[model samples]
Target chain A: MMKGADPDAPRLWREGDRLHVDVRGLCCPEPLVAVLRLIDGGEAGDGLVAHVSQEPLLLYPELNARGWRYRLVAPRGDDEVALEMSRPRA
Target chain B: MTLFLASARSRLLPASVPFRFFAIAAALHVALWVALIFAAGEFTQFRGGVGHALGAAHLLTVGVLTMTAVGAAMQLLPVATTRPLAAVWPTKTVFCLLAPGALALIFGMFAAHVGAMIAGATACAAGLLLFAGLLADNLRRASSMPLVRAYGWAAFVALVLLLALGFALALDNSLGFLADHAGLALVHMILGAFGFMGLLALGLSHVLVPMFALSSAPKGRVAWAGFALAAATVAAAIIGALLGLPSVLAGACGLGFAAALLHLWLMRATLKSGMRKRLGLSFVLVRVAWAALALTPLFGLAALAGWGPGGTLFGLVALGGWLMTFLFAILQRIAPFLASMHVSRTGGGPALLSDFSAAAPLKVHACCHFAALAGLALAIVLDNAPLAALAACVGLAGALAFGLFLAGIVKTLASGKI
Candidate 1:
């Protein structure tokens, strides 16, 4: 289970080897903080995916700082996006 | 994926776009205090007219406040709205027109040159209208953040009225057409300070304060109610000033006080619930600005009651104490934050926020700034010119320290030390 995960928070689940987060309706920093929590809490798996409504521009810097790489995994919709992220290999 | 990346990149404008405005605002912040030093003799007695005092006021209003607001909005709005600006050229054109226009306007005021004042006002009005058009287009397209959008629209309306009144005031300097020039001038100040800038500040706070604190935004009925009351307050205040009715003005102040309390409560809750503790010195300044904001209406009421330099004190607190202080607080954070983003985007690796911030100068600035505000307030109470001049000198020192803080950022970036 994710550390200090709130049941009422945005949906997060695991499937196979990947952790998935859905933060579609959340506002800025909320969406960003959700992902950062997963990363900082050491809950993010080798493969992680996030579904977000906005592009999460502010998140890119934090990801960069943490040595994570992400790429769009789904075709962009008008308001939906899915990004596949991975930890940098040691 | 490539298209997505491109779209994301488009949300952030070129570094030069926002930085130009930030740089100008920094320089003018220093200039404002210097101008105030010369105008200190008139600080207490100043009712409404053109002179060094007015020049200094415009420097803060047009040069620093609006200049910074335009730049930040152009850069941040695209990101927040999830839409890119139609083009960058218009943003550049706004800076070109508004910057020189502001300088000319201040010069004209200081020298009492009606011709220069008219020309400057015209250019400024043109520049602001163009910016307003851009804001409206973005707001029209925005699908999310309805609360911010509502505030943005209200502020937009206020800006339009402010510009029209501003231009008329400039013309009246020569033509003298208006019957109640001074009253209209007071209305112009209220619309500009509280209406346009105040609403924008309150609206942006919903986004900015949360983002900085790493907290969730404030929303729901309370936030909306706060907005409604604030809008009502501005409307009532304008009508009151225009009609020369003290009761209406008092009612406006009461509305404004309620709105301020609600705003402070919202902010306090936001901060308390935030994950990030110890938000650094910028937050200290932000808190002070909030305090100043809360006191503004009380000062206005006192002014109406003819209490102890209340009118001048109210103006000072409203403009310098609340707006200018709040602006500098945010500017310190965003300027470096944006620079870090740009640095990372340009393949400069992850540039830490600390790398671009110099704590020493900022500490000096904070101390001197608070001291200067206190000194100036005391000076106003006593109606002492030399003391006011001395306080302004302290303010100038603080401004210069702030400038050094900014300069350090540029140096770090230029030297590739980050």
Candidate 2:
């Protein structure tokens, strides 16, 4: 069924002090909602991806505020989004 | 299938409407704020770097304020119109061009390099053009909500006018269109603040504050006064600039803004009075912003009344005192709310909204935010750099911690099926 989202090719890639979450191809409540969960778990303050397709692109700031360094990466394909997040001091 | 297609079409054209630009713009806002703190540090109180000040102002206006308004409008348009944006490219285009351009301009200003500034401003203008085109297309079909609708109309017109003025200013700095500078400066400030940000803030706050604070909607007559006053001020200011009048128009514009703020104050007090009990950080933000708004026109009136150093402090009051403080509070709540909303929930998942990171951090942030803002206002009025920076750094701490809050929320979400 599901390919488990490419472990080696993390749709969400994380290096020390950075976390990226790809919520692309999704819509409003979804993008914001997902990011909130991460912040609730204390993943904010550096860079983090709340990546999604164009649908949720405008609502990315919720990611930045919680401390996940926020970067919006829209892959050319309609299906993929890369949210690149980093912490300020790691 | 047909129903789905119709809904999609309604939202896509001219970009999704309830105004989502605020989202993108918000990031830009903070980025600029951070940049300014670092960049402005090099210059002493009277270092006299005209370009530096101008560039920083642009970052605040274009990068921070406009971006947020744009995003917010797009997001809210659907709620207002039951429709979506036409094309997606416009939003992407605006951001893609703007982010880098703003960087370049700010860099140019710091380095005293006109060429970089010109190049950067051009990119920003291109981004703004796309924004205008998309806004115009949306305005033709945007909702019938009077306040929101009028803003759409004004935003389109203002976007075009602002871009043209920005370009001229950029060139003038290089080739010297010195005489036009003062007039254009007035026009630019009027359009940037009063036209775009002011209108958007006035209109959106009607929906936003109520939603966040659980207050009742604004009464019609009061809102109309605000709308009319904001419109009159912009119009008068624009005309005044053209004719070189006795700054009376600007003074009158100040009065108009006061009228608008007063109406909002009435609406706010109504909300506060009706509250069964005080609530979260978001509501705290709602309350604090009013204080900032109160200062805005007080300073405006002081300017009108010819109080000394009123001009200097007014900027502090409006930009730092009002907009920044208000925005931070909203962000704290929205950040968590939006994050939780975006989580891919399982049917059996814990309700994420209820499980947010503790209110303690928010309370801490609030204290820091207010202190920083107070310090900044004092620093500006007193012209104290160290004081301003110290205050800003604290605000930055709260802001940075606010940024950190995202992670806490994520952990809560992923920790379990919740």
Error of 1 at B158 (Å): 0.3
True contacts kept of each: 0.19, 0.00
lDDT of 1 at B105: 95
Best by DockQ: 1
Tell me the spans in candidate 2 whose CA falls farther than 4 Å from its real position.
Answer: A1-90, B1-49, B214-216, B269-279, B304-308, B356-361, B406-418
Q: Over the stretch B22-75, how does candidate 1's per-residue lDDT look in tens digits? A: 889889989998988999999866777999989988999999999989889898
Q: lDDT score, residue A83, model 1?
A: 74
Task: Estimate the lDDT of model 2.
Answer: 0.59
Candidate 2 accuracy as TM-score: 0.70
> Model 2 interface RMSD, in angstroms?
13.9
lDDT for A39 in candidate 2 is 59
Q: Kindly list the per-residue Cα lDDT of model 2 for residues B116-162, writing each as its tens digit.
A: 87898899899878877766666676434556567567756776787
Clashes of each: 0, 112
